[model samples]
Structure formats: C-alpha cells, structure tokens
Target chain A: MFEHLHAGLLAAVSMSNLIALFFGTFVGIVVGILPGLGPMVGMVVLLPFSFAFSPDVALSLLLGVFCGGYFGGAVPAVLLRTPGVPSSLVTSFDGYPLTQKGEAQTALSAALLGSFGGGVISVVILIFLAPALAHVAASFGPPEYFAVAVFGVVLVVMAFREQFARGIMLLGLGFWFSTVGIDGTTLSERFCFGTLSMQNGLDIVPICLGLFGIGQTLILVERDIMKTNDIKLSRSTLDFSAIVKVLKYWKTLIRSGVIGTFVGLLPGTGSILASFLSYDVAKRLSKEKERFGKGTPEGCLASEAGNNAVPAGAMIPLLTLGIPGDALSAVLLGVFTINGIYPGPLLLVKEPVLISTIYISMLLINVVAFLMLIIWLRPFAMIVKVPGKLLAVVIMVISMIGIYAVNTRLFDAGVAIAMGVLGYILLRMGWPVVTLIMGVVLGEIMENRLRETLSLGDGSLGILFQRPICIFLIVLTSLIILIPFVLDIRKNIRNKKLNQF
Target chain B: MPKKDYYSSRAHDLLGSIFGVFALSMLITSPWQVDTSGPDPFYKGPLIFPLIVFCLMLAGSLPSLWRLFRPSEKSSWYLDGQGKPFKTMVILGLLIIYLAGIIFIGLEVSTWLFLLIALKLVNQDSILKLTLIPVLVTLILFVIFKYFLDIWFPEPLIMEIFLE
Candidate 1:
C-alpha cells in the first residue's frame, strides 16, 4: 500500500497531471456554479481532450471535474436559491435562507469546508475499501458479470419506473446502437447500413455530448428559462474564522459522509437521495431541529458533505466493480475504458499505481477546489449571472466541435446531432435521458458475458442459476421488475373488495 | 401525485406507437441484419443477444401500446407535454445550417455567425450581447482550439482552391 501510494504521489505531482488537475477542477467549478449545466455536461464536452493525455492524466482531469463540480454546486444553491446541480437542491433549504439573513458567508463557507471534509473521508474510504471489494469482485466470472449488468439495468429502469415502457424502449435503442459496426466475436459486420462510420460503432462520448449538451440546450431554449431570472450576487468571501465555525460541526460532517458514501455505493441511488437522507437524519438528530429549514450552518454542512462525498463513493463502485453508480460515473466509465483501463477485479490487481494515483488526485482536487472557491468565490458567484441560454448555446457548440475533435470525424458529430434529437424527444416525453446512456455503457459487458456464459453452459441459461452470486443478482433483478406489478395487483384486489362491501 | 400531464393523450399514443413500430422493425429486420450462416445454430448466432433484448422491449412496449388503442381501458394515456418544440426545432434548423456552414465556410466565420444569431434569438434585449459576445467567444474558442489544444479542423471547400 505504501509503495502504491508512493508511486501515486510521484505521478500526481507531475507537471502535466498537476496542470490537468487544476484546469479540470476550474472548469468543473465554473460549470457547477452555472444553473442547468453540471459535471456530466462538462465531462462529456471535455471528454475528447481526455484521449490526448495518458490515462492517469485523463482520469485526473475528468475526476477533478467530477469532484470539483460538487464543490461548486453549493454556490448557486446558497446565493441564488437555484441548485446548480440537482443534488445541491438539499443545500438550498438552509443555504438560501442564510443568504436572506445576510449570513451567506457562513452558509457558503460551511458548505465548502464540509464538502472538502466529506470528499476527503470518502476518498479515504475508497482507498481502503475498494481494494478489498475488488478482491471479492475478482471471483466474478462471465455469469456474474452478466447477471450484475442485468441488475444494473433493472435498477436504472426501476428508478424511472414512472415511465417503465419508455425506459425499456430507450434501453433497447441504446443496445441496438451498441451493436452497430463490426461484431468483435464473429468479425461480422452488423447494423452498419453500408456506412463506414457505422462500421466503427457509435462512440459513447459524442452521444453523451449530444444528449446532455445539445439536447439539453434545446430544452432550455424552449422553456425560455434564461429570461425568467436575473441573477445577482452580493459580495461574499470565506475567511479562516468561517472555517473554524464550520469545523465545529465535525460530527455532522462525518455522519453525512458515511451516509453519502454508503448511499453512493448502491447502484442507481443518486446524490440527491444521499443529500436528502443526510439532511433528514441530521435534522432528526439535532437539538436545534427547528433550525434546519431556516438558515443554519449545520444544515448546509450536512447536505453539502453528503453530496460531495458521493462522487468519491460513486467512484468506489466504478473503479472496483466496473459498474457506475450514477450517470456521472457511467460517463467516467467511458473514460476508463477508452484508455484501456477497464475497472474490475483485474484493475486493482493489474494497475495498483493508477488506482492509487486516482485516489491521491481525488484528494488533491478537493483541496485545490476548496482553496479556489475561497479565493475566487466572488468571481464564480458572479459568473452565475450569465444567462442559461448563452451557456446552453456555448455548450452545444463546444460539444459539436469537441466531439468532432475526438477523431476528427464529421460522422461523430452527425451521431451527436442524431442522438440529440432522440434525447430531446425522450426528455419531452418525460423519459429520463441518462437511461439510454446507462444501457449503452452496460450493453457490451452484458452481451459478451451472456455469450460467454451461454457457451460454457452449451446455450442453456440454467448455468446462471448454479452460481450463488448470479442467483442473488437474478433474484434481486426479478424482484425489482415484479414488485411493482404485484403491489398494483394487490391494490386492485383490495379496491374490488371495498367496492363489494 | 404525478402532475397532470401537459400533453394530451393523443400525443402520448404517438410516442407509444413509435416505440411499437420501432420494436416491430427490430424484430422483422433481425434475420436480415444478423447473419446466422456459421456452423452454430440460430441461438448461437450473433443475432441471439440483440434478439433477446428486442423481445424484452417488445414485451414492455406492446402492453402499453395495446392499452393505448383500447377505448375500454384507461383513455388518458398521457405525456409530459412538449414545452416549445417549434422553438427547439428552429434551433435545430439553425444547428443543421451551422454544420453545413462549417463544411462550406470556415469554422471561425461560421461559428461567429452562428453565435451571433443564437445570442440574438435568446437575448433580443441586449444588442451589445448579440454583437460583442459572439466575437469574444469566437476569438477565445479560436485561441484555445488552435494554439492551446492543438486540435485540427477540417478545411472548408473554399480552401481547396487555395491549396491547389
């Protein structure tokens, strides 16, 4: 462990990696402070650049943005009462009320410091817990992988159970898209439509850029959301005294960090839920329970710590299990795979140095983002005044050009545009856009493992039942799919009995 | 409770039918799209995996689609109404033209023009924002893409004559 950490410390301090870390985090904070644009869009737009650097640098840049965005998300929530990231909505409950009481500094400071503390704790947990988790995951064979992929998909669909059919249809669409280009197993062309571009298969980066970047821009434009609010921020600065004040709530920080990381460990449960859960618990446990909804530093600390802890916690799953816990981590999976660094049991065994560097880089990013937020708090707060529409337009253009730069391919840009339309249609229809991405990310592993498992069993799925882990995964997936239907049937039966009475 | 769906039931039926038709196409085209000529049986063919997925999708969509058409069932199959598709479509049109513009005109010129028009569309109240922000943004993008990032941009068709 010392050897790996020593190597990580060396790699992390390299001039290029350090620069990438700072740059990615800065961009992350800027985007996170902006309304309607969050880490996912920032990561996708910047994903093309990730290929230019080594995997260590690439992951650092993207992960910096991932963690940094959470730190910055608290700003707009506190100052403007608009959660820059959806997860930061919890922060706003106490954050905004504090701003109204002219205590914005205390609120924002506690939020940032608590975020910093939670982020560090989460990384510590990941550094210790992930390797042990990977040891168990090392035993995961083709059947286990296949079953787990199905479980991941089931979790995502169930998260959007309100539109179950829509989720399945979009998942099917993403799976279909993944099957385009040459089939690796058979070396046979599939779904190319006689186009050379399709022969290479669709890249996840461009599709993400389209969906979250361009497609989201269109939604914002249609809503005319930019014209709705004029953003203004009074002067706010974080001092050492504020940090001292925030540190007084160390218990809240630790508790929320644990809750956040544990929630993040679960697949498909997002940071919003983590923040809310942490806030509820903190409120319930507090002697000043009445102070939660009103302006209180403890409330901001709890919520911010919870949300900030989530990125590292989510990375725990992504880095070890090769399964993303949420949409941001799912995109991060693309970066990992693109660099030929597939995260699984093999990752910990094979690339201990890279893993350690990621841990160190995550820690460095938290420190750097916290300091940057403190020093330039006013500027970041002020940039929030930029109209959402302009940001949308800028993001859309960057997405197109950035995606084109990936391989200098016009076809990728076209794919992005096409997916943008599909994403927009889905979003308008009230379907979650990220479900398609989740399906796409898991599709390859699912297919490859299922095929491998089938060949092992001579084309019989009974092999899945034989494995303990696969059986557990399958049973969980089955329950997820069946429980809603069973409950609805019970409801109907009860209603009929009441009517008869 | 769910918000009263903004879109009427008819629009929702359209969405359901789209999925229904898409599923049907996948099922119909699977045989041709997937080759099964190897020594292996159809189950082992490249088609099996996608086939399984499409079947599951059909299972999900078909029930919903069936219920949509049945008047005796819940007649209020609904959608979260599209907020302003006409506006979004207009932006889409602009984006299509922008892509075309990049192919014909150079990236710098087309981007400047695209941002100018886009800014004007979004913030008609600010003339300076429409005129200046575009130029500033374009300049910044050029510096970053050209020098800092070292990204390659495709030369426009007009540049072909200059090359010759």
Candidate 2:
C-alpha cells in the first residue's frame, strides 16, 4: 500500500496531472459559483478533452471539478443568498443570514475551512475503508451483483420520499431509454425503428450535455440575467481572523465530515443528502439551536463539510463495486469505461498505482480549491454578477459545439437537441428528473444482471430468494418501502380524525 | 383552486398524457418493432424488459391522465407555455438554424453568425460587444477545435458544386 502511494505520488505530481488539477479546479470553481451550472455540467463540457488526455490527467481534471464545485458553491450561498449548487442550499440557510448580519467574511471562512477539513477526512476514510469493502465485494457473484443493483435503485427511490411515484415513474422512463439500444444479451434491436443511429443506440455524453448544459440554459434565458446587479460585496471580505474564528467549531466540522462520508457510502445518496443530514444532526446537537438559521457559523460549517466529503466517500463504491452513487459519479463511470478502465474489485489489484494516484489527486484537489478560494474569494463572488442571459448563450454555444466536436456525428447533434427539449420539459414538470437519468445510467446493468441471474435459475424468480444477499436486499427494500407507506397512512388517518372532531 | 404552475407541473401532466399514448402505441406495435430472437431466448428475451417498462409507464400515466380529465381544481386542463415562451421558441428556432448552418455554411462562418445573432437577441446592444465577442469567441473556438484538437466539421454542401 505504501509503495503504491509512493508511486501514486510520483504520477500525481507529473506536469500534465498538475496542470489538469489546476485547470479543472479553476473551471469547477467558476461553474460552482454560477447558479444552475454545477460540477456535472463543467465535467461534461470537459468530457471531450478527457478522451484525449491520460487517465491520471483526465481523472484529476474531473475530480478537481467535482470537489472544487462543492468548495466554491458556498461563496454565492454566503454572500448573495444564491447557492451555486443545490448542495449549498443548506449553506445559505445560515450563510445568507450572516451576510445580512455583516459577518459575510466569517461565514465564508467557516464554510471553506469546513470544506477543507471534510475533504481531508473523506480521503482518510476512503483510504482506510475502500480496500476492505473491495476485498469483501471480490466474492460477489451475479446474484449478488443483481441484488446490489436493485438495492442501489431502491436507495435512490427512498431518497425522493416526497415524490415517490413520480421518482419511480421517471426511473421507469430512464430504464426504457436504456433498453432502446441493441440488447446486450440478445444482440437484438429493441426499438431501432430501422435506423442506423438507433441501431447503434444512445451515448451518455450527448444526453447528459443536452440535459444539463442545454436544458439548464433554456431555463435561465427566460429570466432577466442582470437582475442580480444590485447585489454588492463591499463589506463582505475575509481575513485571517475569520479562519481562526471558524476553527473554534472543530467539533461540528468533524462530526459533519464523518456523517457525510457515511451517508455518501450509501449508493444513490449524493451530496445534497449528506449536507441535509449533517445540517440536521448539527442542529439537533447544538445548544444554540435557535441561532442556527439566524447566522450560526457552525451550521454553515456542517453543511459545507458534509457536502464536501461526499465525492471521496462516493468514490469507494465506484472503485470497489463499479456502482455510481449519483449523476456525477455515473458520468465518471462513463469516462472510466470509455477509457477501458473498468472499475470493480479487480481494479484495485490491477491499477493500484492509478487508484492511489486518484486518491492523492483527490486530496490535492481539496487543498488547491481551498487555497484558491481563500485567495480569490472576492473575485470569485464577482462572477455571480454576470448576466444570466449571457451565460445562457454561452451554454448554448459550448454545448452545441462540444456535442458536435465529439466524433463529429451530425445525428448526435439532433439527439442532443431532442434531449435538451426533453430535459427542459422534465425540469419544468414537478416530476423528479434524477431518477430518470439514473435509470438510464444504471438500467443496463440491472437488466443484464437480472436476466443473467434468472437464466442461471432457468427463469425462476425464486432463484433470487435462494441467495442470502438477494434475500437480504429484498427484505431491506420491502421494509424501506413499507415503513414509510404505513406511516403515511397513519398520518392521514389521524388527520381525518382531527377533522371529524 | 387553479393549480399554480409551479415547476411546470401541468406541462408534466401533458407529457404524461403523451407517455400514456406512447405506451399504448408500443403495446400495440411491439410485435413488429421489437426483435427478440437470439440464443438462450429466455435470457436474451428483449420483450420481457420492454413489457415490464410498458406496464410501469401505463400504470404511472393512466392515473395522471385520468386526473387530467377529471376536471379537478388541483390541476390544470391544458399546458401553459410559460416563461416568455415566445422568446424561448424564437431562440430555439435560431438554434435549429444554427445547427443547419454548421452543415450548410461550414463551422467558421456559422459559429460567428450564430453568436452575433444570439448575443444581439439577448440584448447586448453594444456594437463592440456584439462584434468583438463573436470574433474572439469564434477565434478561440476555431483554434481549440480546428488547430488544437483537429476535429473535422462537415464540409459545406456548396463544396460539391463549386470547384475549390
């Protein structure tokens, strides 16, 4: 392990890797500080270039974007009451209040420090935990793999408890989309419609770019971009004292980081869940609970720490089991497969140096993002003042060009436009979009694995129950589904009784 | 009790109705459209998954479509094209033209013209910004794509007719 780390250090420090780290982090910060454009969009835009670069350089670039996005999201949340990423919405709860109370500098400092601390702890957790998990996962058979996929789907379904049916419906939609291409097991055209493009099936890059990049732009353009011109950052400046002041909440930082890492380990639970969970836990633990929403720096710290830890924590399953936790990691998985680097149990053994380099790169990405934010927090906040329309046009141009540049297929451009339209429609609807995309991403694995398991059992559903892992997953998913459903019924009944009285 | 358009939910319902129609169509047409023949036909059976998907979609959409027709105040009966949709349509039209431009005119001129029109439409009234931003953006795009990455854009259709 130590030898691998040493070799990883050497590879991570190569000029190309360092350049990618800097450039990716820089792009990530800019994207994160901008509303509606998060790390995923930035990563997708950089995806084309990734195909050309070495694995270390490409992974570092995307990793930088992923972690740097979280680090930078807190800026707008702190100063402008606008969270650059959804995960930072929790930050604004306390952060914006601090801004109003003339303590923007302290809020920003605390958020950044918490992010730095969380990032470090997450890497530590990844180092210690991932290998053990990989070792355990090495014994998994098709039944277990099939069970894990189902478990992953259920985990995501449980995440969107508020919109249960819609989440599932969208997931089904994504699954259908995944099945559109030639069947992996059968090599039969399911819905090719006698077209060559349809015969080849859909690629994730174009779909993702269209959905996020183009779709997000269409939404942003409908509003006045210059409306944020009134926001001023004159009084909101950071100092060394702010850092010292933020460190006083070391307890919150550590707790949130651990909570985040644990939650992140759960498949399908992304950074937002981590942030919300950590913030809620901190609120429950704090003696000054009343002060939480009213500019409590600890609240800001917990949320940032929680969200920042997720990328590394999520990387574990991705490295060990080849399962991605969220859209961002799914895209990372896409990149890995495209590069002929399949991440599973064998990955740890086959590419120890590559894996370790990624680990080392993750740690450096956090530090680089932290230092950059500290130095340029002021200029970075200024980005929020840019007109939304201008940014919209920019997304349109780049996404269109980026999609075309990848393989130069005109049909891909058509697919992107169609996807962009679909994405816009989905976004406009109250229906959950993530589930659909996840369905599309994870659907193929579930379909193939489930069919394989069934075929092994001579097409008997009872075969799933024969395996301990599959039985455990089935029971767990049942409980997860049933508990909330029973509780909802009880709540409704109690409400009816109260109305009768 | 008109349902607030929040998140374009009514539009979602409209799409739901469409999905219902899609499911119905697929159920009727799968015999012709889907080809499930292969080795281990049971394992390779493509129809099984689609059947499951079709059932899920119908189950999810039927209730929503029923709700759409029930005349309830909790939802709208029609889709409200929203958020300066006219502007959005115009821009979408411009996007279609831009995409067509890449195939017809070539990458260079198309990008510049598209940017120029798009920047102007977004209310950048300055001649300098309109002119300079396009030139710079086009140059950067050209350099990065053409010179740096060496991607080949579709040749202009006119190249076939003209002696170059």
Candidate 3:
C-alpha cells in the first residue's frame, strides 16, 4: 500500500498530470460561479474529451473538477446568495450573513480552509480503508438497502418542519414520477402516456432546474419586489485575528469532517443531508447555539467542511461496490463505464494503480482550490453586487434554454415549466422541495431493491439479517428513526411541565 | 394561536380532502391491469406497489382532514392564495402549447417564442431588459448547442429549404 501511495504521488507530480489538474480546477471554478450548472453537467460535457488523453491523466482531470467544483460553489453562495449548486445551500446560512456584515474575506477564507481540510481527510480515509469498506458494502443485500432508504425518508420528515401530510404527498408524487419510464424488470412503459421523452423518464437536470432555479427564482422575484434595501457588498478587510478565531474551533472542524465523510459513505443519502446534519450537530454541541444563524465561524466550519468532505466520501461506495453514493458519483460511474473501467470488487486487484491515481488527483485539487480562493476572493465577492432583478432574468433564461438543449425536445421544457408551477404552489404551502427532490431521485432505487428482495424464495427475509453488517445497519436505522420521535415526545413533555409551572 | 391559523387550517382541510379524493380516484380509475406472466413470478408484483401506495395516500390524508375539521393543536403553514393561480395557469398553458408547436413549427421558433413569453412573465417590470436578454440568449444558445456542442436540433422550415 505504501509503495502504491508513493507511485501515485509521483504520477500526480508529472508535468502533464499537473497541467490537467490545473485546467480541470480552473474550468470547475468558472462553472461553479455560474448558476444552474453543476459538477455533473461539467463532467458529462467533458466526457467526450477524455478520449483525447491517457486514462491516468483523464482521471486526474475529472477528479480535479470534482474537488474544485465543490469549493467553487462557495464562491457564488457566499457572494451572490445564489447557492451556485445544491450542496452550497448550507453555506449560504452563515456565509452570506458574514458577507453582509462586511467579513466576506473571513467567511470565504474559513470556507476554503475548512473545505480543504475536510476533503484531504476524506481522501485519506478513502486511501486506507476503501478495500475494507468495500468488503463490508458487498455484504449488504436488498433488505438492508431498503432499510437505509426508509431511514432517508424518515430523515426527510424530521428535517422538514412543515405539515407531514404535504411532505409525504411530495414523496408519493416523486415515486409516481419515477414509475413513468419503462419498468426495468417487466420491460413495459408504466406512464409514458405516448411521449418518447417521458419514456426515458424526466431528466434529473430539468426537474432540478424547475424545482430550484425557476421555482426559486420566482420566489426571489417576489422577495425582491417586497424587500426594502437593495443588496449591498461588504467592504470589510480580512483580519488575521478572524482566522485565529476559527482556528480556536478546530475540534468542531474535525468532528464535522468525520461526520460528513461517514454520511457520504452511506448509500443513497448525499451531501445535502450531511451538511444539514452537521449544522444541527454543531448547534446542539455549541455554547453559542443561538448565534449560529448570525454568522458564527463554527457554523461555517461545520457546514463547509461537511459538504466539501462529501465528494471524496461519495467515491468510497462507488469504487468498492459499484453503487453510487450520490447523484454526482452516479455520473462518475458512467464515466468509468465509458473508459472500460468497471468499479466493483475486481477494481482493487485489477486496477489498483487507477484507484491510487484518483486519490492523488483529489488531494492536489484541494491545494489548487485554496490558491484560487486567495487570488480571486475580492473579484468573486463582486458577484453578489449584481442587481438582484437582473441576475434573476439571466438565471431564468439560462434554465429554460439549458433544459431545452439537453435532447432538443421542447416537451422537456414543458415538463420543467409544469414542475416549476407545482414547486411554487408547494412552496406556498410550506412543503419541503428538497425532500421532494430526494424522494424523486432515491425512490426508484428503493423500489427496485424492494422488488429484488421480495423475489428471493424460501421466505428468507431473514437472509437480510444473516449478514452482521446488515444487522448492524438495521439496528442503526431503527435507532436513528426512533430516537428522533423519542426526543420529540420528551421535549413535548418537558414543555407541558413548564407550561404548568 | 391566531385567527389566521384557524382559517388556514380550515383551508388545508378542504384542499387535502380534495387532493385525497383525487388521488384515490386516480388509483381506482388508472389503466393499470396486472399481467402476471412475463419474467418474474412474485407476490409483490408491479400493481401491488401502486395499490400499497394508494392505500398509504388515503390513510395519510384521513388524519389531516380530521385535523382540519376539528382544529387540533398543530399549526398550519398554508398562505391564503397569495399569488394569482390563473397567471401560473396561463404560463403552464403556454408551455403545453409550446410543446405541441415544436413538432410543427420546429425547435428554434417555438423555443424562441416560449422563452420570450417566459421572460415577460418573470420580469413584468422591465420590458427592455426582458426582450433584449431572451433574444441574445437564444442566439448564443443556438451557437453553443449547434456549432460547439454539435447536438442536433430540428432545422427551421426556412433553413431546411435554404441550407439543404
């Protein structure tokens, strides 16, 4: 392992590989600053170019894009309040507030440093523990997967503080949408309703654009119309003392990074949940919990580190088990497929060098992100000062055109618009759009796995319980779901006692 | 807690009842006939999942509807129909029209017209910015998708005659 590590580091330092890292990270930052474009789109768009380079160099370039893209999202999220990608939504909580308070430099610096630390730590985990983790993941069967999916649904219920019925409705609607394409087992179209585009099912990008961009932009327009003060850029200089203040919270930083990597390693659950969970955990543990929403650096470390650690964490399940841990990793699986590299049990023995190359590339990209942040902090901060109304129009138009360009089908644009309206209505009713999105993406995986489990004969649902890892997952999920309800009931009882007093 | 709370809860009760009934009816009336003999023989087949989901939907709606009628301690988050539903309805209607138009009028024209109207709808205050942005965007997108990305779009009827 040490020998492979040395080889990987030397390979990473080659002139061509270093150049590839720089180029990928540079493009990633630009794409991250732009709204409605994400690492998946960036990867898919660049897939064809991979044919032009060697496998090692291509992997280096793509991993560079992945690591750099995660940090890049912080640029727009902190500066423009646009949340350049979905994972960055958590960053906007303290990040934007810090920016408004004229500490844009401090906020961005904390985010960059936290992102770098978390990413490197996660890569280290991947390097040392991936084969062992893959052995564990291989033991997981359909029933355990189903239990995890149920845990994801329950997490959505707890996180979303709206009427439970509406949230469930969104889940049901998403599940129904998932059944639209051809049934994978039965080979019959469930709800194509005569359109070929729907036959492939709704594209995730179009659905995402409608829910977040168009739906969100409309809400932004309404807010802007009602808002009193225009968006103002902060003029605060970066203070060295502020950097030292964040360093004081190093324990919280490491804890959040570990939590994020663990969450990322979990199948189906992704960065969005990891970031929010870290925020909640940080708040619960902090002496200044009440100050979290008001630009606390501890809050920044928890969320930024939590989200940034996820890309590396996501690669764990993908490289080891052939299961994608999140949406972006799912696309990376496709890239691996295109390059004739099957990422499963055989990957460790058959292609150990390739795996080492990816790890080395991930580490190098974090350094690139840090350097980019230092040079471009002020220039990037200027993004928020773009007039809100103008920024909105650009987002809307780009969303419309980008969705249409995917397959050259205007029907997709229609699907996006209809969803946009539905999303707007759901927003008015206080339903959680993010939970609905999670349902849409994860529901199909859960459904297919459930079907597979039930198909196994001899009534051995106990087959799932046979494996120790499966048993552990079942116990853990039960605890996660039940503990929340128990806590909620306990709080209610305590509140009743207080009221009586 | 407030009068606004009472009214909103009542409204949710009504809306949930309507949606619940609609969902149940769709389940019953949906054209899902079970064919058992294809590839896999299992108890929990394709139709079973849909049926279970429908049952869950109806069951979930019952408690919410009961709360609406009885006014329970739970708070409701519904706002009182704040924006005009009809304007959104019109935008949806135009989108459908644009989809149908794509088969006849082709991609560029329908896309151009759809975006122009969508821009107008989103930014009603700035006509000049709205008009200028959409046109420039459509052309630039045309270049990116057509020349650079090299994906195929339906050629306009005029371009089909002239360029071909």
Candidate 4:
C-alpha cells in the first residue's frame, strides 16, 4: 500500500495535476461558501471540463473540488449562522453561537483543523480498509439495507433527543414527500395528482434551499436586519491557541471521523446524517454536555470532521463495489466512466497506478485547501460584517437563482418558496427541520429495501428477523432509541427518592 | 418573582389536525392504484406508504389537539413579538409576487424588483445603493448562470424589446 501510495505521489506531482487541483479547490471553496450551492453542483458544473483532461488530472481536479467544498461550507456556517450546505447545518448549532460571542476566529480555526484532520484520517482509512469495508457493505442485502436506513432515521430523531416527538412528525412528513413520485417497483404514480413535474418527486436541492436559505432570510427580515457595526472581530486571523484548544478534543475528532467514514461507506446514507450522528455522539460523550449547542468547540469540530471525511470514505464503495455512496460520488462515477476507468471489484487489480494517483492527489488537495482557508481566514470572517439587510437581499437573490439554476426549472423555484414558507412556520413552532431532511434522504431506500425484503420472503415478515445483520441492526436501533428514555426514567426515580428523604 | 408563562391560541394545532384529517381522507379516497401484476401478487400498492404517513400525522396531531382543548401554558405561536406578523405577511406577499414575476416577466427583472422591495422592507438604505446593488447582483447572476453555466431563462418583455 505504501509503495503504491509513493507511486501515486510521484504521478500526482506533475505540474498539470497540481494546477488542476488548485483551480478545482478554488472553485469548490467559492461554491461551498455560497448558500444553496454544494459539492454536487460544483462537480456537475465542472464535469464537462473533465472530458478535456487525462483521467488522473480530471479525477484529481474533481476530488479537489469535493474535498474543498466540504470545508468551505463551514465558513458561512460559523460566521454568518447560515450553513452553505446541508451537512454544515450541524456545524452552525455551536458555530453561530461562537460567532455571536465574538469568537468567530476560534470557530473558523477549529472548523478548518477538524476538516483537515477528518480528510486525512478518512483518506488513511480509505487506503487501508477499502477492500474490507467494501466486502462488508456488499454483504448488506435488502433487509440489512432497510434496517440500516431505519437506523439512520432513528439516529437523526435521537440527535434531537429533547424534541423527539416533533422530529418524528417532521420525519413522517419527509417520508410522505419522498413517496410523492411514481412508485419504482409498482410502476404507479402515487401523489402527483396528474401533474407531470410532481411525477418526478421533490428535489432535495429546492427543499434544502427553502428550509435553510429562504427560511433564514425570512427570520433576518423579521429581526429588522442586524447592524454590521454590532459585530466585532478579534485581532487574530487564524488562532493557533484556538486550534490547540480544539485538538484537546482529539477523541471526538477521531471518533467522528470514524463514524463519518463508516456511514459514508453505506451507499445511500450521506454526509448530512454522518455529521448529525457525530454531533450527537460527541454530545453524549462530553462531560460538559450542556455546552454542546452553546458555542462548544467540540460540537463544531465533530460536525466539520464528520462531514469532511465523507469524500474519501464515499470513494470506498464507489471504487470497490461500483456503487456511488451519495450524489457527488454518483457524479464522480459518471466522470470515471467517461474517462474509460470503470471502478468495481477489479478496479484495483486493473488500475493500481491510477487509483494510487487519485489517493495521493486527494491527500495533497485536502492539505492545500486547509492552508488556503487559513491564509484567507480574515476575508471570510469579514463577510459577516456586511450589513445584515444587504446580506439578506443577497442571500435571497442567490437562493432564488441557485434553485432555478439546478435544472433550469421554474417549478423548483416555486417548490423552494413553498418550502421556505413551510420552514418558516416550522421554525416558528420550534420543529426540527434537520430530521425532515434525514427522512427524505433515507425514506426511499427504506421503503424500497423493505419491499424487496418482503418480496424475497414471499411476503413473510420473518425474513427480516432471519438475517443476522438485520437482527444486529434492529437490536442496535432499539438500544439507541431506548437508552435515553431509560436514563430519563432513572434520573426521575433518583429525584423522587431524594425528595422522599 | 417567578417567570410568568404565556399561552398561545390553539389555532395552529387545530389547523394542523384538520390538514392531517384532510390528507388522510384524500389518501383513502384517491383512485390511483399501484400495479401489483408483476410476480408479487400480495404486495401492497403504492398507496400504503403514503397512507401510513397520513395515519402517523393524524396520530401525532391528536395530542396537540387534545392539549389545545385542555388549555395548557405554551409559548406564543408568533416567532417575533406583536406587530411583526404584519412584517412577515408583507415579506411572504413579496415572495409570492417575485415567483409570479419570474414566470411572467423573467429572472433578471423579477430578481431586481424582488430585491428592491425586500431591501426596502428590511432596511432604509439610500435609493442609489439599493438600485445599484440589485442591478449589479442581477447582472452578475445572469452572467454566471446564462453566459458561464449555460442555464436558460425566459427572456423578459423589456429584454425582448431591447433586442428587437
């Protein structure tokens, strides 16, 4: 492995590869910093250009964008209290609080370091464990996949432990939305109501934009536009001390990275779930759990690291199984196919040098992107000082344009506006929108897998119980859901005993 | 002194439950059926998942409706304080107008109008700054999407006239 990595490093050091990496990273960061634009969009926009370059150069460029985009979203999340992408939503829980406390520099540093650590760690994991993990993933049959999907959704609801009921309701709504399109198995339209557009179901992009972007804009508009002068930036640009402080939570960084990689290896579970699950796990492990949503560096670190790890971890499945882990990897799959390099079980056997080059390029791009962000930290931080009213207009315009640009569909823009209104209402009611997103992400997978499992069993429900992996997942899901309630009951009982005394 | 608790009206809860019930009724009554002809004859139709969701929604909303009738202390439904409802309504109204404008007029013209209205609602910026910012933002977006990314938008009446 080390020998291959060395060969890859030698291949990746060419001037053309380096230049492509730099440009891709630059574009990725810019795209990520803008609300409603994510790594998928960045890759999609640049995909045409990939046809012009060699496979190694093209893959390096796209992977650079993928890595940089994940980290770039954290910038807006920490400073502006707006997540540039769905995964960054977890980052903003504590990131925005730190910003409000005038520690935006500290937050940005932690985010960058966490992202860098995650990227490197996941690449390492990908290098060593890709074959083993892919074998495990390949064993996941329909029942196990269904169980995993259920587990992911349950984890999302559990992430909002205080508001589990509300989360469940929102998740149900998300699942319903997912079922709106034509049924894949039965070849029947479900909830289109005769509309051609609705037959395709709701797009995740518009939903995200409506919930996070437009919804946030409405709140800013209602707050009377926060004044730019009110925000005070600290003297330091990239705080080494703050970075050191975050490093103290090395356990959290490592754990979240591991969690992210494992989740990313799952074909359908995306980075959004990975980050949320990581944040939840971090909070559960923290001695100072109360500080989690209130400017805790640990929260930001966990989320940033968890999401940043996904690019490499996602590659594990794409390379070994010919299965893209998520949307971005799906796009990368197309890029690979276009470049005449089909990734499957035989990929490593056939194209060891090319695979190694890709790995080395990823490592270099991750480091370069982090360094560039640190150098440009001050300018990024200064964006928050833009007049809130002006920023609001900018956000709205960008969101509208971004939604429209996705498929050049006016219907998507309308969906975004409608969702924006719904999100605003839900926000006012203190409902968890993140859970809804998770449900949408996992719902189709669960439904389809469940149907497949049932069909395989000839409609016998016992098939789920018969599978060892499914049983294990079911038990894990039950434990995760039940442990909190059990803890709450124990706390209540102890309090009652004390009151008796 | 102990903190005083304020309770909001149960209107939202009532409406939510009503919507759930309505959705459930529609799901039950819908004629669109799933094709179960392929091999698996016993497979429940496509309506099953949606029906399950509506049922869950109904079940979840029931407690909220019950609490509404019982008159318990709750936070206010309004996100901001009094008089902000008007502001929210105005913003939502503008959003609706913007959507309509995008369809009828075009992206550039609609975006310009939306920004001007939205900015005026949110802040008391100078007319020149507001005008310049919106026009520049619209142009930059147009260039990025239309010229660079090759995304298409309906040509506005004004743009058509200018081209002619």
What fraction of the reference interface contacts is present in each model, in order? 0.48, 0.55, 0.25, 0.53
As for candidate 2, its interface RMSD to one decimal place is: 1.8
Model 2 residue A478 CA deviation in Å: 1.1
Task: For candidate 1, give the DockQ.
Answer: 0.58
Off by over 4 Å in 1: A226-235, A488-501, B1-10, B71-83, B148-150, B161-164
Chain B TM-scores of the candidates: 0.80, 0.83, 0.65, 0.71
lDDT of 2 by residue, A1-501 (tens): 999999999999999999999999999999899987789888888887787788889999999999999998999888787888999999999999998887888888889999999999999999989899989888888788888877887788778876665676778778887888687767888788889888767777788777777777877777663246545454434577889988988999999999999888887788998999999999999988999999999999999999999999989888998888887888888788778898888899999999999999999999899899888778888888777787788678777887888778877778888888877777755466777777887778778787878788888778888888779888988898899989999999999999999
Model 4: residues with Cα > 4 Å off, grouped in runs: A1-115, A224-365, A497-501, B1-19, B30-44, B73-85, B157-164
Candidate 2: DockQ?
0.61
Q: Is model 2 an incorrect, acceptable, medium or high docking prediction?
A: medium
* Model 3 clashing residue pairs (backbone): none
Q: Model 3: which docking level applies?
A: acceptable
Interface Cα RMSD for all candidates? Answer: 1.7, 1.8, 3.6, 3.0
DockQ, all candidates in order = 0.58, 0.61, 0.33, 0.43
Candidate 4 yields a Cα-based lDDT of 0.75
